[model samples]
Target: MKFIKTVSLAIVGTALAIGGAAAQGKTVKIATEGAYAPWNFTGAGGKLEGFEIDLANDLCARMKIKCEMVAQDWDGIIPALNAKKYDAIMAGMSITDERKKVIDFSVSYANSPNGFLVAKSSPLAKMPGTGEAFSLNSQKEAAEKAIDAVKPVLKGKTIGVQGSTIHAAFADKYFKGTADVREYKTTEQHDLDLAAGRIDAVLADSTAIIGTLEKPEFKDYVMVGPSITGGMLGNGVGVGVRKGDVELKKGFDEAIRAAVADGTITKLSKKWFKIDIAPRS
Candidate 1:
């Protein structure tokens, strides 16, 4: 009888320990820029909404972890993550080699191409290659040709891009001396400057520019030039994590893969972006 009691107590203790470990494993805080629309943004009453928010919740549930979403500035996000301000970043952050040196990233969840937004009346709108997709990795010649085609039109024109983004990097690399590149703290600010004629063109993600162009005030604005991807744009959008947080990165990677396999990412993409931007297998 005593042996039976001892064995039951041992089982209970093991169960308790497992339960405690599971509880301790969860409870992570994630950061987003809240200014990047459709991917993430502040909605009515300042509530965070959009694709990343929905995707974050879904990924957290699949990981069986409790997550808290916090809004952080775009430029400061990585530094703050390294400072331990958040456990992960889901604000449409791309997986870039430059960023990989400081932090780690999970498998890409989505890949939205970048492009230029210009007023329909602008001469730059006449630049060639309307709907062509250019991959710097696989289609370097084509991407370079497209860049060369637009360089003449953009000469002496001021292009606005969000600072610290791939778009900014692209602008610096290709248009620095050819055109004046203006950097803004947020996409919204650049959109405003573009709308006000303060900047001749804006370089940003196609989906984000679509969000702006859909607004009644931006009726004259249209996305132009080749849709760009790969190369300096990075591998795609992924969850950014601290370099040493391998376990957390693993959890997010597993959750992202499961979501991709189950079509949840496609469903969410269509809902927010009106198109499927899920990373190709």
Candidate 2:
């Protein structure tokens, strides 16, 4: 349904917003995967933390809005968003053409790229060709050449990505025919699978993987691949809002700009990712 029945929304609230703090009459339930670590993920005690969490709270304070963060599984996130289960989405969601048809996007809050990681013991551990950046949209030949180079090694290899995510789209577009793509419900699941040898590799946000690689459990994994953006990746992660509600969208855009200008984003990025991804440029 386009707009959720009140009873349905209530049930969803309890199920997805367990940790959500109750405030006054006005509350904006924000939807997230709650599993895209470093973007937005649950901490050890199962509390929300990451770059998006900091940004969300900062934006809410900037807009003087009463907000609560809710964890929505990746696949049903848009459905939940359209159903009014949440007022906004900030779960490292990219702004793409398909999504724009159903929901509107505020200005992009952050722009990071997709990358591949393999067990350090794997042969393809060192990416064929890499530098600062590359793109499939604008540099088709080079990107395809890179893909071709890795095809032999990656063939039959199981690569895990979050389901219904931009990472999945990227894999399908470039590597699906050449390799087996395994979809997971969350990035953390893929991370676990890669560690357990269930999957040969993982393709996800570099920002997200940095968190996984930090743990002692993932010590043997290495980020080995060209980082990618543009084209299939869309315009980086942004806020997803229902059509209209211009005031809330504008408020978020202004708040993001303010956060960027004042260096809050860099600070948060450094804290979470241990590197500054504030301005992807």
Candidate 3:
């Protein structure tokens, strides 16, 4: 994801006006998976501190609403939201068509590509398009070419991905027949398995993998293969709201627009991920 370079003052002003008008002084309960580092995770004292946590606070302030953030397991986040356990979800959830069928999404707040984490000593480390980013929609040929190039190396390899995630979907779509796909409840579980040499590789968001690589235990692992985006990965990350909550979605969308217009998202992203992943205007 590229850094947000320029923001239109006019857009900021418009967003603020909309946000002010939409403000209802209502309390909004937001849920996040506390395990996804640099996005939303538990800190030293079990307090949530990360990009999405900060962004959620900023957006809530902009919306003039009281916000309560709760850490929910990734696998059950959506179900809990539908169960009315939370008004919204600020987790690092991609806005895919399948998810949209059950919940509405605010405008995207951040954009990060997905990739693989493999041991540096593995042959898969030399997979084609090592540092290149591919969008299945705009760069279909290039993405397919990279996938073809890596297929041979991936054949018969056991890969792990967090269940109910885009990474899992991608593995099922691309490697089901060629590779052994294992699903875990959390990325941390798969990361542990990767370190134990239980899985040949793990596929996940590049941002998440960066966090994993920073840990001393994962020193042997490195992000490899082509950076993936588009298609099933969906359009960046957005706040998930119930389908009936149109007004809530509108309020969040306006706040997100304001945050993007003023560069708050980009600023927070850098502070957390050390990279600019603000959604492109």
Candidate 4:
């Protein structure tokens, strides 16, 4: 009788462990700002589609969880995640220190630099260091020089950026005094303003700029200036979760690593951004 009871207790414990695992894998609610094109966007039928969308599905599959992706406004994405409206965020969110103070991020799956979009005829089109790349953390002097080189043309010009983003922070820090920085609610809004000549240029992710440039209306537009990364740009794009969700974080981290190793991210990035934005590390 003693041995039978001991065996029954062991089986109960095993069942409980299995039940916990199943509950954890049941479903993961993910949020994405369906406005950031090529990263994520609303399609013709109000369906969410983009690089991050595909990557989110892949990551969820790797973790053996069903993913339900919901479109959330960009400005409220982080707060919504904290409110438990969603279990995770795969909205091309960069892992900046300021953001990390609130929510934890999984291993970065992609990294892309930021730049300016200007009309071909604009004086800023000739902004110096056109094809150069700079890491403010690794090469501060050169990056600062590159930044200074473009300031003259940018002086007195108005630049548009999506509000509450790193690009906005960058413009505020580096170009505020020299140039008028206008914050828009979305990249599409700023692109419209740029097309209407309301703003001289738009500062944004290179991938996003490239997406805009592909449109027929933007035929005359071009991405100018150096590609800026590191420093204020943060540590690349990752899946964001609440700070206390360690198991969920671990699952995403492992999934991302697996996806990176298998070239899945590279394939999806090329399909969307036409460039490899895979995290270097």
Candidate 5:
């Protein structure tokens, strides 16, 4: 879901663990933005629970390394990783060329499309190509055409997107001048604003939009418009680690491949997202 952010050195806060301290031997402190539900989020009593949380545990077991999961703010997640605040990140981070310059990513573990969320009663609920899908990378013309189809309906609407996300960049590129594209610090923040009627629509990962729709408070909201993937949206979601951490990256890659091969990813994704998001490539 992420776009890009300049790395910062400022220390934010102490990382909070979701699991008990790991046993000795090369503990990998994994950072997660414990707010994006279905992907990762803080559960009851501050316990972390979600797809990535489960996947992290499985991957760690496969790697035979001690794993520590910690909560980190989304905006500074990459910077924190570079700053040594965490050994890796598994917070539904997309593997984009832009991000690869600052950090390395393991082979993609999951892939999902991006879309819009709007009130069921809103006119945008009739957004064109509502259930259709397009890839900006392989279907550039079609994807651009699909985007053009939604522009008129979104022209004067207010759209909310999580800051430092591909959705933010997409909104800026296509909807900023015509629509009021607002940025929030996290998906939950935007979801709140959307629920409060502060925003006309929200552009985010379809899985995240689905997460919002699962909430009773968000029952009136519906995912609309074409599902978008690839291009600036990123290759797919992967494990983000410091650029120099080749061994760690290699380990994660192997583990993820195994997980995908063995249907671990499929099982976890279905458990959380109700669909298989395992990367096909």
Candidate 6:
């Protein structure tokens, strides 16, 4: 009787595991911002070409599964993910403790700090802290020093950033009340405004600014000030999955780690952003 009972328990465990696997294998839909350039923005021809698109494709290849990517507004991406509009989100979203409460992450695949973008000829291009890196969490003293140094040059200047992004968070943390912060729905729209002299400077992701700098219309725009991460900027970008999908989350985590290990992510990052930012270490 003891042996029979043990065998039954083992069989039940196996059945439960198989059921979990089957549930995870049921198609996954990935969502992206679809407006942030060099991340997941739509091109002039309405084609998606950017870092997130490339990395998402690479991860799907690693998983050896058929997946669909949907373009949605950034503000609604997370809520929609929770609402089942998509199984996961691949936008350039930082994995933070607050965000963790509502969803899970599939490992961070890429990271670039919040950086400043300005017209090449603008005085803001000469702002202090140029070509430097600082972390608000690791080295608060130095990060504040950098902020204090840049404050003078940015004083009373209008800064443009996308609405509801980490950039906005950073502006609130460091530049709020000091600089006039304007928010835009799309990076392209702000890029146009910056080109038209509507805003003195723009704060956003480094890779996104690279996309803006590549455009003929923004031929003279440049990155200035310090590259910042950690603290309010939060952790690196990752695939956000719904809560309670631990099986699906584990599959994606394994696939993402495998892709990074095989250099698939590095290759795609370079292909799209001209940089190599695979899983860090």
Error of 2 at 221 (Å): 0.9
lDDT of 2 at 33: 75
Query: What are the Cα lDDT values of the candidates?
Result: 0.84, 0.76, 0.83, 0.85, 0.86, 0.77
lDDT of model number 6:
0.77
TM-score-best of 2 and 6: 6
lDDT of 5 by residue, 68-106 (tens): 788888888899989988789999999999999999999
Residues 83-139 of candidate 1: C-alpha lDDT, one tens digit per residue: 987778898998999999999999999999998999999998886877888898999
| lDDT by residue (tens digit), candidate 2, 88-151 | 8988988888889999998877777777888888886866764446776788787667767777
TM-score of 1: 0.91
What TM-score should be assigned to candidate 4? Answer: 0.92
> In candidate 3, what are the lDDT values of residues 1-281, reduced to their tens digit?
21112111111112222222234433467888888887988776667777888888888778666677888888888999899887889889999999999999999999999888999999888877888889987998888788787888999999999999999999999888999999998888999999999999999999999989989988887899898898889999999988877778888898899999999988998888888999996
Total backbone collisions, model 4? 0
Clashing pairs in 4: none
RMSD vs true structure, all candidates: 9.9, 6.3, 6.7, 9.8, 6.7, 10.1
> Over 4 Å off in model 6, which ranges?
1-25
TM-score-better candidate, 3 vs 4 = 4
Decide which is better by lDDT, 2 or 5: 5
The residue-by-residue lDDT of candidate 4 on 199-233, one tens digit each, is: 99999999999899989999999999999998989
